[model samples]
Target: MRNARRVILCLGLALAASEPLATLATPAEAFAAQPQVYVVRPGDTLWGIAAHFLKNPWDWPLLWRRNPAIHNPNLIYPGDRIVLRYDAAGVPQLQVIQLRPKMTVSPIPSYHTGVMLPFLGSPGLIAKRSDYERLPYIAAADDSDTIFSNGNRLYVKQLGNLAPGTLLRVVRAGPQLVRPSDRKPLGHALIDLGTAKVLHDGALAEIEITNAREEITLGDRLVPETPVPEPHFFPSSPAHPIQGHIVGSLSNFPEMMVGQVVVVDQGSDAGLVPGNVLQIDGPESVTRDAVTGEHLTLPGRDVGSLMLFRVLPEVSFAVITVAKRGIRVGDALRSPPPEAPKVLGIAP
Candidate 1:
């Protein structure tokens, strides 16, 4: 009896190992076996629609194979057709071959001056001092250390080789400014002091400086500005733009300002990148009930826009160039709306 039981147990184990186990059908398998066509609708995002047929929304990018027509990949419009093709092994594939209206990229010119920071590629480089630090680094144009008695004149410890008629900027030094919500420190704002001319050069240089707008004082650090290439702004597509709140900024360099860094809530998971322009909008107006005195905040109105200059896996840096109103920390952002089509058929 024992020998027979052992033989039966071994046979059961072999059968369990050899036979294909029963499992739940994946969304792709289901979609492939029973294909359904979904028409593109207004206010529908590809990420949303793809989620219906795919277990992971990020896998949507894998659907298109060598299709050049879909350049932006984010702009799928209403009345467009998105087909779901299935493979012989019962796997669904999403193919967005249909073309829609093309979105034009808005062009804007801007200038920037700063040193190119060294890029740390790997952890091994951190131990090597030569890989981490770069000499002759560009510093901010404004640094001073004169004791001011209610005057704009700035005194420096040493003028070095500063010549006459050289341009300079005035900046204040204090504890690094931190973001109120996230406790991340942003670089101090540099007040442009117009230009300066060296009157005397020695251990200290008595330079005649122009106070642009803000007050100048003592103990401000003075440094030379390094000329760098200007930054360009690239607008996003009309269909999909990201929206989020500013979190913090990066301050690894002296001239690098963190205020320019706009930390939105969206990230790589949302398909964001450097050079993508996002339209910034302010908070919605608040509506109050007359009887109970209760107030409701409506969706915020669109105000202005910004162009992302730099991007990270979770954060991005954007410059505010065309803000109708002042942009705050928690402003909303979206893709700029497409231009209205020309009317021709209707009579005037």
Candidate 2:
């Protein structure tokens, strides 16, 4: 018994020397609180949901990283309940409990990780306005070749320090896009023609045309390429009330169909995000009063919905997910299509 007491006294002194002077809890631990449960409402988004719990919306990754519960943290559906709780360590955690599965299969291949495409698109496409200003231009083509096509060599000028094998998109900077309602110029429509691969780099770089959707011509600008965005960009109603019109169609079609990309005048500057879904509608004339000559408007008809794939400052690229009617340029795009009018019924 005496030996055990002496050993315990010595062990206690050793443990005291090893005691930490300061203890700091992790960031998640600092967020300790009672679990706050939220029921996902119509038009709810993972981005908005994360923002609701975390005052700093951008810190959402902290709540989801390494979490075993959410396989795809970016995607969540309405009617799902999310819990914001603290663990035994007092660390905060975000989890989802779905009452029903809410995934819809899309026709287009939205994401890929296994097979490789023969070609990769522009790496520096997601860029600022300044990057577009000094874009390279096709100075000359193969000898006596007035038009550029696939596998043809292009003499490009104004190219910076691009290494060999860099990808670029052949385009024509069409026009300064302006909002019709306010005549506010947003961005220029850089019509995509095709893509090219940098063969050699220099003051005047040599590029080999890889894919030619349209006839690549001299003076055609080779702007940076934008790739397919994240798969988290799902279709959902816009967060803020939005009213705008289709400015242009990527296909240049007067009337567009489902599964096509179109440009809308509204963008991030107008409260639009990458996942926002806009309602497409068209209005018809109800009738003209015979005596007064006043015009009456028909309730706007819902044509389709556009899911944004990319968002710029004042312009966005959207895909017509569901085309109930023909989508056309100048058609109205609303956040949530106005509800259908209804009347009370009387029973005899």
Candidate 3:
């Protein structure tokens, strides 16, 4: 338990030091009734932490106060101290103090672990046919080996001279992705096979598999490893209203649940970027009106929410953050409704 007077003194000092505090208009009731100081632990995510203190996790951006000097202001890591305080106007806010400031690698704020990390770090889809076909593939292996695993040497043709220590991602091309609404082609999906290093570079270069998610077989394509950086972002509504649908699943599953990645038809062209949260609705159903003998179309019920973590030209990859019911391909999505204002007194 915190000493009441001591906490009061700490707040007094923090408020005194935090000069020219920015005035926020977010309602006090949006915050937790008894918000406490939280220390970020390993495996903790920004979404999970925000959901701990706010009514809606997407409301994080409104309540979070970031330090602009940091490389990635919104990416909080383990050991950081999160403090909750109210301004003179009684508007609640969340602030953080970095405890481990010298760490080399800055971890991602959203979907950093479990099933979503691999998809985020690897190639999930390529939006162009020419781009997919231009990548180099394994032309031959030692002794004509049909399948290779970690630590096995292989030969790749068309891999051009570069360097000896470059890392590459092994992938297999899958079926073409299409928009669920009009069945228009979007791009081709890529299956992440594994990671490999360049022992030699040039046409007919020698390489060795360093990691394998699936068996690295003959003719698997190789593309330069995509660097996954800590996104300078926070969950917020899209700038403009967006209407899209779940076109496909990254895992090729018929149904999707929380923490699973799904491909959406809207992308950069639709003004979407990382950390944009959207609402999900089921497909509309047509029914017959008994009394008037008329056919009626009823809109789908609000099922859940999703956040965009990866965006391309015409499509983007999103993870299901909330699922009220089963989510599937062809389910409708739109900009989340505005948060309803609440009137409540602030209590410490």
Candidate number with greatest TM-score = 3
Greater lDDT among 2 and 3 belongs to 3
Return the top candidate by lDDT: 3
Question: Quick one: how many clashes does candidate 1 have?
Answer: 6
C-alpha TM-score for every candidate: 0.38, 0.59, 0.76
Better of 1 and 3 by lDDT: 3
Candidate 2 Cα errors over 4 Å, as ranges:
1-134, 226-230, 283-287, 290-294, 337-348
Backbone steric clashes in candidate 2, count: 0
Which digits, one per residue and each the tens of the lDDT, describe model 3 over residues 180-247? 77889987767777889999987689999998887889888998887775554666678889999888
Comparison by lDDT, 1 against 2, better one: 2
Task: List where candidate 1 sits over 4 angstroms from the true fold.
Answer: 1-154, 158-168, 173-181, 195-203, 208-215, 236-275, 284-286, 289-295, 308-330, 334-348
Rank order by lDDT, top first? 3, 2, 1
**Predicted structure 3: lDDT:** 0.70
Cα RMSDs, all models: 20.0, 17.6, 7.6
The digit string of per-residue lDDT tens for model 1 on 120-220 reads 11010111223223211112224454333222344455556667666444433323334444554444322232334455555656655553333444444
